[model samples]
Target: MLKLFYTPHTSALATRIVLEEVGAKYEITLIDFEKNEQCSPEYLKINPRGRVPSLVTDSGVLTETPALLVYLAQLFPQSRLAPIDDPYLFAEVQSFNSFICSNLHVAHSHRMRGHRWADEPAAIEAMKRKVPQTVKVAFEQVERHLLRGPWVLGEQYTVSDAYLFTMAQWMEADGVDPSSFPKVLDHRNRMSLRPAVRSALRQELGDQ
Candidate 1:
């Protein structure tokens, strides 16, 4: 069985959605940010970076949402969660995930995680104030180019969809109007309707 450590409303939700989509038998351990459990020594042992979405596998542990999504898709190829067979298509998937991880996610982080990049209060406030524009610009690129349609890679429902959807959920909180990006909003709505996505969300949000 696979074990996943995660917190609600975080990038880990992408990994959880992939796990559910793959029908993988797994259990999740929540690391409550409110309680600072993520910074505890025990959790630190599991993930040296003390980040959520750490997957404990038979071989070892896997961190990072993009890697975990790809691993699960490849592990259960029958699910067809990714286009692993095609090098180009698979690279496209990787490219999209990388953008979410390196660009979009980082943009969102600046709103509250300004401390990660700055110590001066003025610098932190500046980053926070710039979040709206930076995040809007980042999503504009997705809206105009990166987002390939119905699913990130066009008709196919790849793991990239989950990753994109995860970040899309942050639009409002990041101060960007989701309506500004119709395609991304539509994709988010479509993904929300997926049974696997719903199940993962319900679990994370403790929805019943």
Candidate 2:
């Protein structure tokens, strides 16, 4: 069995979605990042970077949202989370994964984690203010590359769809205009309807 160390409303939700999509059962341990529990000695032992979405497998611990998604995609090939048969399409999937993580995720991180980059309060505030513009720029690229579909990859659903959906869910909170990209909006709505995605959301949001 896998043990997932996660925090709600983080990129970790993507991992949970992938796991659920594959019907994998795992123990979920919530690391209250809001309260700085990730910094605790125990969690730091699990993940030196003190990040959420650490997967403790029989082998060892795994971190990084994109890495975890890729791992699970291979582990459960029947889920068809990725394109292992087509090299070009697989390359495309990897490209999009990096784009979402490097551009989209990094842009939004400035809003909440400015302290990681700068010490001065002014610098932190500047980063926070830059989030909207940065997110807008990144999302615009996502909007442009989004295939004509309810999914990022068009006809087939991939792990990248869940990844993008996780980032898209933060558009409104980051002050990015979600309406500008109607296709992406439709993609998000479609993702919201998936049972796996719904399961992840329920765990992350704690439904009443």
Task: Report the C-alpha lDDT of model 1 over 36-85, residue by residue, as the tens digit.
Answer: 89989999999998888899999999999989999999999999989999
Clashes by residue pair, model 1: none
Clashing pairs in 2: none
Give the least accurate 10-residue stretch of model 2, judged by summed lDDT: 144-153
Task: Give a tens-digit lDDT track for model 2, residues 111-198.
Answer: 9999899999999999999999999999888888655575778888999998999999999999988898888898999899999999
Q: Which model scores highest in TM-score?
A: 1
Off by over 4 Å in 2: 146-148
Q: How accurate locally is residue 19 in candidate 1, as Cα lDDT from 0 to 100?
A: 90
**Candidate 1: misplaced stretches above 4 Å?**
none
TM-score of each: 0.97, 0.96
TM-score (C-alpha) between model 2 and the true structure? 0.96
